[model samples]
Target: MNRISMVAVLIAGVMPFTVGCATKKYTREQAAPIINKTNELDDLTAKNSRDIKDTDRRAQSGIADAQAKATTADQHAVQAGQQADAANKNATQVNGQVASLAGTVENLDNYKPVAESSVHFGFDKADLTKKAKDALDQLGGQFSSTKHFIIEVEGSTDSTGDADYNYQLSKRRADAVIQYLADKYQIPAHKIYLIGLGKDKPVEKNATSEGRAKNRRVDVRLMTNTGDQQQNASANTPQGGK
Candidate 1:
């Protein structure tokens, strides 16, 4: 119960409190790293999740773009196929017409020139003038009394332009003439053998305007079998010694 005993008791009591604080500090120190590590792991997991979401979004966008492009390409391919099919169908039709015409050209007899003509056109013209129509009408009238005649048509062009262009132009001009004759006189399409000679057979020089004009012409001739010609000639002969 003296000063030393009292001091000893006080020290004993303070020792227990200090020991408890030390133990608590040690436990906190030990758990502090674990808590800090757990927080760090959570932050890392969240960042990884965000990264994964961003990657997924980008992947989806890329896939969508690719799908759109693929669809567009497929559409283009379909259109190309349709165009090719149309072209093939047109080619088949043209081939059939040509074949039919070929069969009509095999007659062995009665192929002589009955009438001839030169249909002229102005610069870059595929249309017939009034004078050209009149000439065609006269030819048609003359042929009204003839029998089994086939018209041979040769389309020509001047040498003033590109050869291929001139060839097509000459063909158009010939087509114009043929169409006119067919529509006006009811001539059959098979009675015509037409060609576009272009600048290959020029009637005159293309250097001059007048010469070019002369070159822009279609030479047409009518031909008939020998039997028909003779019959017509005999019919036309005057009756003698009757």
Candidate 2:
């Protein structure tokens, strides 16, 4: 009775423990595939997030490249517009010069020379020398009795600088002469015809210093359409001072 009773008690206790272990093992096996599936899903989500970030970076880079290209195109357009404007301005200047030449040719015979003078200047200088001023004074004296007269002032320059710079220099020389005449004789603006020839019409070759000095000069010719005015001006024509 004692052995049988002990054996039955031990069997009952062992049966419950074995059943509990089997249930625990079956639960673990069933949850294992779900855990692996969850792990796989987590890995896919992380890869998708990385791919989305990389795509966004590439899209931002592409947009930046497009913006850079657009900025470069805008700069090129601005440069092209500036160049076109410069070309148009040059064309307009040329047309005005042609019209001026035509007018001069048409009115050539309407005037006759009454008095003439020439004044020289220093290198790159527009200020009048004492001798040059004295020479101009002689020409200015003739304007008192002259009527309906025009003073032709042709300024020149030596070939020593840029063509555009020389043109401006010659114009400054001409302005100096005009100022003296206008101030001293009260000459009207309409009675003066001015031209800046620059180095295009040098009186002497520019190869020598003396020749260049001679080229830096302004030529003045007092002219009138009226015969009586011309005769009157001839009496006061400048002599050796010119």
Candidate 3:
């Protein structure tokens, strides 16, 4: 050994030791930063997962609440609809009853006479016969018992005369009956309404003498009172005058 060879050998051995120490230091520093970053990321991920689970729970609760409210609302609507239908049905029934009452009132107000007796007239004359006068006198007695009385003296004639002449003659016959009742029984003239149907409503055939005599007659109709008719109708009803 020379001096230069000894120096080179020692330097080479020392350089290897220094290189190994530097490599170990660098590996430790890099591994520490990586581990810290990984831990931070894991914490953030756990927090986000918990938040998502809480949001899902809140959403489920909201859905349940909404469903309950909807069910209650549906039930209320059904009840309201049923009540309204019942009210409408009741109104319809009331309207029908009112209409029926109105119709009955109208019918009573417009009541006309129904024929109860008849009087025969002469062949061509409108004069009152003795038999006719007797019949009229009997009818006049019934007027005092009635609430309202109207003597509808409707005269009819035989088919032998002309239509115009017969109508006039029938009118004269009704007038004569009214006058006779007024003069004999002191009945008011306004109580009687004279009408002449002529041969329009002949009760018998016009070809025979007996039929002609039958046709030439006056109908004395006695009308029932509105109260009486109403009472009759009420008697026939199910509610019995309610």
TM-score of 1: 0.55
Per-model TM values vs. the true structure: 0.55, 0.51, 0.48
For model 2, state the Cα shift of residue 196 in Å.
0.5
Name the better of 2 and 3 by lDDT: 2
Error of 2 at 183 (Å): 0.4
lDDT (Cα, tens digit) per residue for candidate 1, span 1-242: 99999999999989989999999999999999999999999999999999999999999999999999999999999999999999999889878877756755776254778777788998888898888777777777867876767788889988877889999999998898899889988887767888999989998888899999999998878777856658889999999995
Candidate 2 clash figure, as a count: 0
Tens-digit per-residue lDDT, 1-242, candidate 2: 69999999999989988999999999999999999999999999999999999999999999999999999999999999999999999889878866755664577687789999999999999999999999999998989888767799999999998999999999999999999999988986656889999999988899999999999999999987789546769989976764
Clashing pairs in 1: 110-225, 110-226
Worst ten in a row by lDDT for model 3: 107-116
lDDT of each: 0.86, 0.91, 0.82
Reference-based TM-score, model 3: 0.48
What's every prediction's RMSD, in angstroms? 8.6, 11.5, 19.6
User: Residue 26 error for model 2, in Å?
Assistant: 99
Candidates 1 and 2 compared: the better one by lDDT is: 2
* Off by more than 4 A, model 3: 1-109, 112-115, 229-242
